[model samples]
Target: MSGSLLDLVKALPTDPSWGPPTTTETMLNGVPYAAFSKGDKLGRMADWTTEGKDREGRGGRQQYNQRYRDQIYGAGPALQTVFNIEGQNEENTFSLVDNSRTTIRTRGFGRGGGTVFRGRGQRGGPTQRGGRGTFQRVGGRGGQQGYDNRGGRGGRGGRRFGWKDYDKPQRNREASVQPKDSWKVVEEIDFSRLTKLNLETGDGEDIDDYGFLYYYDRSFDKQPGAPTSVKKLNVLERAAYNITTSNDPVIQELAERDEATIFATDNILSMLMCAPRSVYSWDLVITRHNNKIYIDKREGSSLDMVTVNENAADAPLEISEGNKDSINSPAQLMMEATHINNVFPLQTVIESDTAKREMPHEHPFYNASEETDPPASKAYKYRRFDLSLEADPEPLHLIVRTELDAVVKNNISGEDQFLTIKALNEFDNRAQGSGGALDWRTKLASQRGAVVATEMKNNSCKLARWTVQSILAKADLMKLGFVSRANPKTSNDHIILGVLGYKPREFAVQMNLNLNNGWAIVRTFVDMVMKEPDGKYVLVKDPNKPTIRLYNVPKDTFEEDEGDGIGMSVVGEDGEE
Candidate 1:
């Protein structure tokens, strides 16, 4: 038998195709032919269950093992058949659905270093089991425990309870004037776009100066917020006017003579220039008639009111938003601040007609017969800034009616320095929306810098607007009075804590305010209006978003209200209202 086996092996070697085939043909019919070494050990021809189990359990390594199995059996085509069978089989198509709850054991550092099971508990709520670091349930229904890493119902890793957190109520301020269906949206410019604009303008030329300024009281400049320095904010019955752009007599005369293409009051113009810094909503009425643009505000506009903590992260909340403190509410605080500003300037100056600085023109809005009280210490300077680009055929100018509050005698030059006085009021520092301000009554003496810095941060928009107005009017100094409420719970009375003075240009530098950017913003809006036809356009700042939209409307849009005498009466050049 051994001799016969030896003869058969010799015969297999003698035959040319008896040994391992060396043919280069890759496929025998439709099956892929895989070349394998003679030393390779062959496994089972087809083990579908094990292959499937390996693939589901071992992932990529199982796939590698399957490939190795395929090479051993030369069954790559058979594996494709098995895949096709599994895909087409109706039995395989139907999956067993487990109705009962499932517990998924995941690798986690649990209690006693065991695996954690995340599953539904007996109380019909999701629970994390077997871990000290397991999520604690909170605010679940029916005594059901729900997984919460932060031990709260909201979510994991939310803002902590603080002034700038979700605990603070949301402020949803209404627009100064809502848009009508008739109004057509012309352009929408974002605050981001306005910030990038820059255009250098020349120092405006003074067209005419109106009104007179009383000499500033030097005694109020003593140590602010001190017992000796604090004074009651008195209500002054002075004729102070905030006339709109189109209603101003001087601007009307300038428009007829074509002195400038654009006209705006310092109030309206400053708001537009400092729009990017503003957090609240405001609207400007832009009337284009006979190639002239007038920027005006609506009757009973919020722009007329001074805001409190407007730029704060957590600004004053409205009473509707669960704020029970009516005195500290946004509307009341605004009224308090506005009243203080109107009276603070008048109180800070000595109303002496003999020692006052009189303008070239008399007070434009003050009347001798119709008004009972004396005129406020105010100076209206109609200044014209050159907004002309090099490409323009004619010089484009903007005439802004800027105001000065008081006049101070310069100690060094002995010249009278013009001043623009604005007040920053403080409510309860412990109250909500205080913007982390210091106690001005105590800190204003030694930590005055810190108090002022806090005011600058919280009241950035208001301060920026005041600075812009001062710079536009060419005022030498900007006086900021620190006013606080007499009682935290009452808005009826206020006390002047202190008066801080700053040079307009220097303050602009510290605030990083770019007048060139403001001029560019003005020019951009001017160009937008210039391109459109003669009509009434409203530039509205979005109440919630940082955007300003320009809408075109009919000429008679706001005329009904104006006809009702809702706005300030038009004052003539002869000081007749």
Candidate 2:
């Protein structure tokens, strides 16, 4: 506490990286002490001997208070009684020394005319032992009274701010209901209007065909009026501009009434372009059945991709152009022609009775070590989502599908194969209807709107993202198998189904024809291919009615098959060749 140690102070280095002084132990007068310094710079020193005495005094005072409780509240006994106390209390209070003082307590009108303190340890002189109000107790200070500096009956306790509030929070009151929060009001959208707009295809493909389904999210920016010109506009920019320029009264009214900020590179650009933001997108599923195509649509939000700070609405928004494929692939020009757009491969689906009846262990690819058995035998069928499961009796899917030419390559053969793929698309149906898996999501969009400023306590996207990712990761194209009949009007007409088992590639085999239903039952197997006379591997084709083409032998072999059993043949029943 003296300046005499000034000469002992070390000169500070000019290096800016070095910080304040640190403490170390040293001996002072044959007793341990704490010296805070950097090098020779003396900052502070505390004698261990004096520290122990200070601790003892605090313990003595606390003991005195407890022993004489109920006599004068915080007031303790005489100094002699304090020194006579025994061992320290179990819990330490970080008290250094025992100092006694008196505090004057004056009653003030609090809420409901209840008593409150005017000041703590103010306007009072020290008193002897056993005196009332000797130690000042901290509480609400005097401002206007009623615990919150309010005078009138209307005042409860200032205002009850949220935990996130920067101002002082008012004391809890039982009489008041919770305050209304404005941030809870999410932006409103008219989903129906969006559905009418022709969706933009990123790859410039004409998707405005008859069987295409379209969905629009209402969360996108909707500016009023038309732009003066149109240049340097993004995809969303162009669309928003067109919408604003529309003569439609509804569109004009929406544009004119918005009180929010409008930004653009030029007067010609659209509001969405000037202030870039993620727009609402949809998942489109196209189905082609019996040569006719059908489409289903569902709405999804891209708001999460645009991080908003609700705390500061006017703050510059941080945009994260997340994996565009997962958001809206068709809208991105590059993804339109890729196989990544298709989530399902219909051609690979196996359609055989054997698959339905046999076990996974019995399949040809059943390698217990590799676990690469066929999906059908393993019960790994593609998943289908049905909205009817929620309430509608009919099923619905949020899955999206697009057509692309996928390239298949063989590593060992160095052969590249290009195949047309009509499969599932990356964009999936999410936030469908209003219940079950999408319940929380619908509620969040309803409350938080399209832009969220802060992190929500309950994350609703986890489930939706999982659903989409699972469908993408687990879907694939598997080979198909089928069983068929060769001919009718004959007994013992047992014929092997389409393509024999994957193994044993010889052409010589027995045939059976059961045409009871005009076509025999077809049992399919994976890797079932045929080797023609020219040695080319090809899929087994369906047999034509009235005739069957046998391979790898002379034309007259069918007439003389009973000899070698290695050539083509056409025989009636009774095991005759």
In candidate 1, which residue pairs get closer than 3 Å at backbone N, Cα or C atoms, i.e. clash? none
How far is 365's C-alpha from truth in model 2 (Å)? 39
lDDT of 2 at 11: 34
Query: What C-alpha lDDT, on a 0 to 100 scale, does residue 310 get in candidate 2?
Result: 15
Q: Rate the local accuracy (lDDT) of all candidates.
A: 0.79, 0.22
For model 2, state the Cα shift of residue 501 in Å. Answer: 33
Candidate 1 wrong stretches, greater than 4 Å:
1-164, 167-171, 563-577
For residues 1-577, could you state the per-residue lDDT of candidate 1 as single tens digits? 3443224333442334555654444466865445433333666456555544241255575665555543435334444555456446856778888746455544433222332234453333444345444544333233333445643443223333653465655667788788999999999999999999999899989989998889999988988878998898877666667778787878889899988889998999999999999988999999988888889998777888888899887787888888878988888888778777777888898977589898899888777998777777889999999998999999988899999998989999999999999998888999988999999888899998898888889989999999999999999999889888898888777888888899999999988899999989988998999999998999999998899999998888877776432243332222223
TM-score of each: 0.71, 0.17
Lowest summed lDDT across 10 adjacent residues in model 2 is found at 518-527
lDDT of 1 at 457: 90
Cα error, residue 268 of model 1, in Å, equals 0.5
